[model samples]
Target: MIKTIIFDFGNVFINLDINGALQHVRDTFKIDTLSDEMTAFNSLYEQGLISTDEFLEFYTENFPKLSKEELVDVWSFMLKDFPEHRLRFLKQLKSTSKYKLILLSNTNELHITWIKKHIPFYSDFKNCFDAFYLSHEINLVKPNPNIYKFVLNQNTLTANECLFIDDNADNIDTAKSLGIKTWRIDIESEDVTNLFNVKTNLF
Candidate 1:
């Protein structure tokens, strides 16, 4: 029996144009792909090992032609619309009080800042979860077994009793390896609002 539900914040909730964002950045920077150093910097930033000021400074120094605001805009372009029906579903689920709800996401500061500014019901969405863990805030990220261990340990939750839902295959694999049930949502044909119907076997 699944007593807890852990959800990914990106494609599972808010829409993300990951490929589109990467293409936009490549075109803006006139680079075919992100360099190793840039990738490392992003990982460090997501792990909260670096401050937001330091992150912005690195980008500003590398691309002197681009302002901090422009860089933020490009970085945050991956975040798309968050449907209200998802919030409604979450609210209804919370109201049931039948299971522990946790939100686990690998997100950075700029992306969250953009979300808070653009999403009118951010607080309502957040309140639906009993625990909310963001990578930068928690200094841990998905696909890392330690992060899952931390959540289980923190909540005294047995992995077998928790269902982890994410859009990332790697993340799902890690959770499954940890003995947690998982749903790798297909964003193209699946909507989170249909969770009960889609995951009927689990329920």
Candidate 2:
């Protein structure tokens, strides 16, 4: 019996063009590939180990030709629209009160700020979850066993009783290794609104 449902924010909720964003960054930087240092900086930023100002400063210093506003726009280009049907489904699920709803997302300040500004129903969507954990705020990231452990421990939730849905294969694999049921959603073809129909056995 699954008592709790954990959801990933990107792709599972808001659409993300991850590859597109990376291509944009590469073009802007005139680089063929992202360096190991750049990847490390991104991880540090996501973990909240660095401030937003510091993050911006690193980019501004490296790409002196780009203005602050341009940097922000490129950084946030990956995020896309949040479909209304998904929000409706989530709201309905919350109303049922049959399962504990939780949202776990690997997100940072600038991205979330863009979400709040673009998605008008951000609060309504947020309130549907019993608990919301953002990586930057929590200083815990996915594909990491410690973060999954933190969620289970903090909520007093047994891994077997929780079903996590994410678009990332590594994240799903990590959750499964911890004895948590998971769905690695196909963002290109599947809709989260079909959760009950798709995972009928779980229900």
Model 2 stretches with alpha carbons more than 4 Å out: none
TM-scores of all models? Answer: 0.99, 0.99
lDDT of each: 0.95, 0.95
Q: In candidate 1, what are the lDDT values of residues 86-154, reduced to their tens digit?
A: 999999999999999999999999889999999999999999999999999999988999999999999
lDDT of model 1, residue 29: 91
Candidate 2 total steric clashes: 0
